[model samples]
Structure formats: structure tokens, C-alpha cells
Target: MSEATEVKKVGQTPVSNSEAVKVANTSGTTPVDTSKSTDKKKKKKKKRTNISKIENYFPDGVYPEGEWMNYDQDFNLARTTDEEKRYLTRDLENQDHWNEVRKAAEIHRRVRKNVEGKIHPGMRLTEIADLIENTTRKYTDAEDLTKMDDPTSRGIGFPTGLSINDIAAHFTPNKGDKTILRYEDVMKVDFGVQVNGNIIDSAWTVSFDPQYDNLLTAVREATNTGIKEAGIDVRLTDIGEAIQEVMESYEVEINGDTYGVKPCRNLCGHNIGPWRIHGGKSVPIVKNGDITKMEEGEHFAIETFGSTGSGYVTTEGECSHYAVQDYDYDAPSLPSANKLLETINKSFGTLPFCRRYLDKIGEDEHEYALNYLVKQGYVQDYPPLVDIPGSYTAQYEHTILLHPNKKEIVSRGDDY
Candidate 1:
């Protein structure tokens, strides 16, 4: 897709997906190969990544898609009002879908850690990317794991955040790209994968600097606070507020300049579901809107993150992907759009919109095809930054299931 057509997010423009990638790649600081004098030091200090065992981590009784055998009233507070209860019931079904997603995410995280510590700086980005993809291939439920091999296939997108010191995020190193890792530079590895339509969202920064320990500590604390304070019947804003409060407490001075931290405006956490990669509601780690209530049986990725720079963010980048759905020309599909249901079914099969597939279709039929695809749960849009400066971003996320009696965190530290 061209950059011009991508501007219209959700039927917004002319920027193509390819144009967005070009713009994002060129906009970031030029990648510079650095020295590895500290390589041995890192080798000695790097901790082994011990991912949790699948059987022990995900017990048999722990079913995904929010099927809790027991529901407590305290946890059911979100459904207090009769109307609210009805709404909560529907949300619970959505939560059930998320439960599966949470499991998928947990598995992805484990897969990542299985090789994370062993991968050293100075390795070709493509090499590491291939390894990550291969790890996923062994376990993914997707019919086509081969798509992941292609950087543009959307099978499993690669890392863009941890390229080097000057580079920030959204980088997919091609086989010909001459970029290599370095020791002095901290690497941020971020990946997302789906299982049975459930999405796993996560990112990690691997740094050699001792100060990184502090950064990790602060970020983990802020993230935990956001999770601890979040609950059913709770507002969404509270999650961000919790993150903000924790971050503010640790505000520090760098190079004689006083600076507080904030999450890159572009990196807010999101809601996920059976058919949705990034759901309708966005949960910001920093306060922005009303507090979103937490409901029992709801599934979510509570990611608490902040950066050392200005919290403001902007993306002029073209839309690289769009969640296309089959819709009739008779009515719009955005707000309470149920009238277009039949059109969607007739137009596309039960699959979400994926840009790779759309590029092959004709322009006249593209819209209908996308609409139908999205409606069928085959397509989902992924917007890419075009001609926008990249920023340093960090995140700590865990796919979780909210239980009335106990909260189930899918991604736990490895016991082995």
C-alpha cells in the first residue's frame, strides 16, 4: 500500500502499507554499528531465560475464554445495576474469548524467553527475527506459519524497538539490510502473535547498563500498581492514574535536568478478544479519559509503561494495515453498525481482514472484500508510522483473566 492511501485509518486515506514501512524506516535515526568491547562482560552477567512450564503454568482447570466455574458477588460488582448486569454478561462472553488469547500470549512470551537471553548483540536482526518466528511456528495454531517468514506477511511481525541506541521501534530488518546488533546499545524486543484469534501483546528491553536494573524495577513497580488497582466495576482511567502515580514518585534528574517520565502517547495498552487484535477500548497507562470498569471474566493485557522523554506522540505514518470487514453499501459500519451484517456475510468468509490478502484484490471490490473479511473475523488493521520520528518505548505486559475470587495472570515468571 502507498503512504498517501494509508492516512485514512478505517477508510481514512490513500497511503499504502508499503509506503508506511518506508516512511517509518527512514524517519528513525540512522542505524550505526557499535563496538562490543563489553561483550564478554554481558556474557558473564546475562541471566538465563527460564520460561514457565506449560503444564504447570496453565493448569487444566484454567480454561481460556472466561469460563470460571465460580463467580463471586464482590467480583460481580460491575454488574450491580440490572441493565449493567446484562451488559456485564455480554462482556463476560468477550472475556471468555480473551482467556484463550491470554493463554496464547503467555505461550508467546515463554517462546520469546526460551531464546531471548542467548541471543547476543551484534547478531543480524534477521537472524534473531527468524529464531523468534521459528519458536512460534512450533506452537502456533495458525494454519500458515510460513507467512511469518516474510517480513510483510503479518504471520508474526519482528522487532523494531531494539535496533540500536538511536533507533526506537517499528523496524523489520530485511535479509539484505546490513544492520547488526552492538553491546553498548540496549535492545528492546517486542512481538505479538495470535492463537485461535486471541492476541498476545508484549515487549521487553534488554540492557547491559547497571542502571537498566533501576529502569526495569521502576517500570515493573508501575506496571504492577496498574494491575493491582485494576478490577471489575473499576474505571479504565484508574489504571493509567495508578501508573502515573507510581512513575511520578520515581521522577529523577538526568544531567542536571529535572525530567518526569510518561508513556509515549503512541503506546497506550489495548483490549483484545477472540476476533480482535486490538479491541474497541484502549487502556492507557497514563490518565486520559474516564475510568474504565473492570468486570469479572474480562480478559485484558495490563501493560504499564513510561518513557524519559515528552509523553506527547504523533503518527503521520500511513496505515500499513486495516481491519477490513464485509459491509453493505446501504449503511455505515462504525457506530452501532449492525445493519451491514448481511452484506458482510455475503461479501467475505469468516476471517479477519489482513492487508497482505487485500493487496491482491481489485480496488472496486477491495472495500467490500475488506468489510466482508473483517466481518467474518479474517482481517484486522495495523497502522504504521510514516515520516514520523521514533521514540524510546518500554512495556511490561501480561495477558490476564479477572476472576471473582482470584485473578489469573497467564504469563508468570518461569519456575524452572
Candidate 2:
């Protein structure tokens, strides 16, 4: 091609072919390489991909519906103010709430470490529960007010439940229960700590014998597996399914028999909120078709209770744990009922508190008080879980903050 095929000089007005020729000749530079320029133009036309359609941000199908990380773009707003951007992007508001949650979680972790550290094979279950609850008060800062709305009411949202052996959870020692831990027993302690009613629920099993070690390990792996498969907008069902897969993959040797492991189906981890322990949505150990999506700024207790027996647990013993019935109703006339109701509403709110927790309020007749509240529909008793006799159970848990980029395991440092 002739020089007339190109402009005489770059950035100058487009000249006629004859003028371009003269300008190129006088400029003392070779005629422009139109082919190279055309190649550069083609390079600049690279396709702009819409990241909203990308696959899951976390690998291994953590987000079942694929990662919807484009929250800002999904809203279909091209231009947004900085204030509006905080809704899509994590801001100080989010961090502020997380800070309190992390603080409470750390407190729970440390106090639990101190309490459980003293556990021995001969330790009484009642003493262990007392030790845990007392130590929790030592580390916590709960202040009861006349109403749950009071910001001052913050502390052990879910009281210590020192469940052992077949008891998967919801077992705290009553005033005179003389159960003791044996060398071969598997102990599962489930508890929660709250800061301004922001809850971080967690649990774990401890076994001294090497035989039951694998059961503890299986539950731990299942819990972590669930956490790994959790991310923003992930299907709640996928998390449960992944946990079940991992739990079943583990094999444990018990009583000279090799057994495959799986989580108890009836019991599950739960979504947590301020002043609410298990309300948002239940995260089952097995899939149950809950398509609820985990959003940012939400908290969850990712827990697994793996058992050597059938993957089912039933409440067959006395209820040692209690929670206020989360219904809108008026208080009853029984003096003991009103007394327990006031204490629950003031401090525990809708969260679960131990039957022994009433001791802190100087209540000795807990059975009658609880019974009164139960009959009045002011409280619900969480009965102790019983597995098939001779079969063992183990548990592992962690609290998580479902941020867009990743999940923050608030109680991650707790021993697995």
C-alpha cells in the first residue's frame, strides 16, 4: 500500500492523500505501519466479561448456585454514592458488629479452655457443668435488665451443656445429678457466648481413650467440611450435604469392629442472630432441601455430631436444659413461674439457659420453677439426647461470619 493509504502524521487533522504524502516525506519517519496499528486496535477490542456470571468463588462447590459476588452489579445500578456502596461492600458498620462478635467468641474460647482443661476421667458431670458456668461468669459480663431490649443484657446466651456419651447435646447437670466421666467416655460440651446479645455458638468432644479418638476426629472433619463449603449466597442445603458426605467418609474402630461414621440426623447446627440462638434456618447434618441463601453480615454455628450408632438421636431422659418459648404471650400468675419468666426475659431472652443457671439468681426449687414455666407455656425444656445403648457420639462446632470474600470462623481457635 502507498503512504496515501495512511494519515500524513499522527494527531494532526486528516489531510488529503496528496498532502499526507508530502507530510510523511518531510517528517523523516517511515510511513505509519497501518497493519500494526490495526493489530493494536484489535487488541483494545478485547471482550469485557460480566463477572456476575462466573462460577463459584470457592472451589469444591461451596456455593451451590455458583458465586454471586457481583452484588453491586446484580442490583443493576451502574453509579452509586459512597453511602449506598456500603450496602454492597463491607463497611465500618459491618466491622463494628463483627468486632463485638469476635470479642465474645474469644472470651468463650479462653474461658472454655480454662474450664475444660481441668476435666479428668473422674470428674463429676455436675461439677464440670458448674465449673464451666462459673468460669463463664468469671470471664463474661452479663447484666440482666427488666426487658430483653435493654442493651446492657449481654452474656452466656446458651448455657453450658456437658453432654456425655450418647447424649449428643442439651445436657447440663441439674442440682443433684451425680454422673461422672469415665476414662473411655466421650464428652460433648455445647455452649455459647454473647456480646450485647450477639451469639457465637460452639461445641466439641473430648475423649481420653484412643478408641474413641476417631469419633472426635470424624466430627471435627465434618464440621470443617461444612465450613469449607460455606460462602456468600451458598445454598444452605449444600452445606449440610457436604457435611454428611465428609462424615460418612470417616471410619472408626469401636469394640473390635470397624464402623462407618455419619452425623445424627435429628440434631443440627443453627443460624444465630442477636438475642436469637436458633431461629433463622436450621443447618442439618444431612440435606433437607432448604434453599435459603446465606447473606453477608449473618452469623451461623457450623456444627456436626457424628455418631458410631444409627445416625439418629432421641430425647429419652430428663430435660436439663431450657429456653423461653419464643411466642408472644403474657406471663402466668404462679409466683415461681413469674419469677423464672422475669429472669429468663431479663437475661436469657429467647436464648437457651441451663436449669442450673437459675442458681445464679438464687433459685433452689428449679424443678418446680421450670415445671411451672413449662406448663404455663413460658418455657420449653430441651431434653437430653439418648443414642442407641453402647453406641458413642461426638461433636464439633464453630461460629462463622459469612462475608462475601470468605467466612470468618469466629470460634476457630477452639481445640477440635
Candidate 3:
């Protein structure tokens, strides 16, 4: 989760420094006369559009009084052209849906920017998780989980994943866990934000040492390659081949040993649906024979992982990520398990949750109930997806919305 210095509007040019100064002067401060300024040549400022004012899109702020719908007439009017409007109204069928998706993506971008450069070697993993989750709660206005039953409730889509070193994904700090980041560790920060179940899943790798720069670059470029290759009717296999070509081409050397970056063959990005993180289709990192074509009006998380060891991951360590199974099944016999299931349905629905979230909502001493639900096939437990032990891994991900007219990289930022 990296970010740019200033937030830019979608399909709009960035505000220049002079325009920024003009904005800063509106706060009851005397404006500086640019006529007396040093520069001889004056550049004309581009006309600002309503779309550039992100605040207009969220007129009532991040939290709405009722449903999280944008009632602003300018919301639809802000489109750059009539074709863009048709893409939203006719093709997508709902302008507010895409608006919510963009809002959720913006929340992710802002939170990631706030937390960047704050993670250091000595911070506890729990501290880092809390920092990220709390910031997300503040931005989404869903701080109170007990009151998250609103139709357009906005909050974390899943637990904050702080997977480190060989662990590629699905690892979060459980309650009382005391793991600390070290100077040489390569940590992957993965998180999601959801507005009315439109989840924006994005991630990036961080390392204090410079030796892993190539590793980070390979995975990041691979992710961007996938994004660039993805389109309305693009075959999934071609995108994977393009990703692998960029990712596997780079090699990293550490301690007099060179390791060719390998795409994690077992892990692949997937399509995302409402309240569903992994929606049916898989976007592979390496070239495969799967002939899935990315459809218009579909959302996807195009993530890539580069590993120094085997280009595969296995489930290991403590399980923290959990989601209610989508299939229908018989209810558990245990009353506690039934209660836990009820809670999960009420608070998270089909979205993922962690043990730490359960504790946050005052579910104390409920391990047995949680385990019972999992054993009864009422829930799915996701353990840490790790590569070979002692081998380093890096990951980069971005969420894409495939519109009929154009593909929007919703989770994109300056710092990939």
C-alpha cells in the first residue's frame, strides 16, 4: 500500500503548485502576488472539474445518514464526457455503484498513505495491525462493529494482513500475539476497504534493507503488467504470461548468492464480487491453460507474488483469516457455535473476519465455538500461505474495475 504526495482525481490532471498555493490562500490568508514572483513565464491553470473535487462525490462525508448513496446531482454530471456517462448508466447500469467503488478505493489509498513510512523494524505486529485497522475504521466511519448492520455499512473488508518474510498472505496478528518486525525482514502489508460490499483489495511489500529492492520491483512490475494487460475481453492466460515474463526476468543477489525471482505458481489473483473477495475466476501469475475471459463490469484483484525459493506456497502457522462458507449447510448442534455463526452473519456476512475482530466485538473465550463452527463446515479458516522456510517473498496487488469503455485501476497509487 503505497501512495502519492497529493491525491489526484480520476481522469483529471494533477493540480499544479501554483494552484495549490491559490487553494492554500483561501483560508483567510493574504494571497501572494504572482506578478512580482521570480518566474518570467506564467502557465495557465487547467479548468477544475467537479470530479476533481473528491469531496463533492462524498457530499455528506464518508458516512451517510442512511444508505451510502451519493445524492449530489453533480455526481453523475462530473463525468468527463457523455460516453463516460453512458459507460456508467447503460453498461454498468448504476452510477452510484461505481461511485461507491471509487470511494472505497479512495479510502484504501488515503489509509495506506497515512501508514506508509510509519512501519519500522521495532514495531510489534499487533501495533501495526491496530494502526492500520483503526485508521480504516476512522475513515470508513464504522468504528462501532456492533452497529455495522446498516445497509451501506462501510468498514474493513477483511483483517489487516501483516505477512512477513516467507509468509506470502493470509497472516494477521491474533490477540496476544507478540511477533515483532526485524531490520532484515521483508513484510507484505495487505488490507481491504469496503463500501456497501464493494471491496478494494490492495497490497505492497516493505523492506528496510536495500538487498530486497529487486524482489519488490519484480513483484510490483508484474502486478502492473497484469493490470496493463487486463481488459474487458482479455484472456486470463495471456495476462498471466505477461506477468510471469516481467516477474521472472529479474534476479536478486544477497550474501554472494543470486536468486532468480520466481512467480508463486500456486497463488493467483481472482475476480471480486459483492461481499465476495474471491469471485470464481482466477488470474494466474504464470502462464496456464485456463481460458477464462475477463468480462465487462467485473472487478478483479490482479496480485502477483515473487519468491526466492519454490514458486509455491503451503498453509502453515496459526490461522487468523476466516470467512463464512457460501454454501448452505446444516446448523451446528452446539448453542455457542450457533451464536458465533449468528454473530458472523450479522457483523461480517460473506466478508472475511479474524479472531482479533471477534475479540473486538466482545466475544470472549469463544475459541471452542469458533472451532466448532469451522469443524461443522459453517466457516472456512485460512492459515498463513507461506513459501519455503527461510526463503524471502514479496507481493504487490491492485484492484481493477473493467468498465465497458475503459478499465479503471481503482486501487492504483503513485507508489506501487
Estimated TM-score for each candidate = 0.59, 0.75, 0.80
State which candidate has the highest TM-score. Answer: 3
| Per-residue error (Å), model 2, residue 182 | 0.4
lDDT of 1 by residue, 79-143 (tens): 45565555545556666555556556556656766775767756776677666755664545332
The sequence of per-residue lDDT tens digits that candidate 3 reaches over residues 1-416 is: 22228766889977666786788799888988664452555555675522222344478755221112121223333434765666555654755777788888887887888787889888899999998888788778778888655623678989998999999999999999989898889999999999889999999998988999999999999998888788766789989999999999999997679999999999999999898999999999999988888886898999999999898999999899999996676777899899888888888889999999999988977799999888878899999999998899999999987765566787877677
Ten-residue segment with the worst summed lDDT in candidate 3? 63-72
- Looking at candidate 1, the ten consecutive residues that score lowest on lDDT are 150-159
Q: Give the top-scoring candidate (lDDT).
A: 3
Model 2 — which ten-residue stretch has the worst lDDT? 61-70
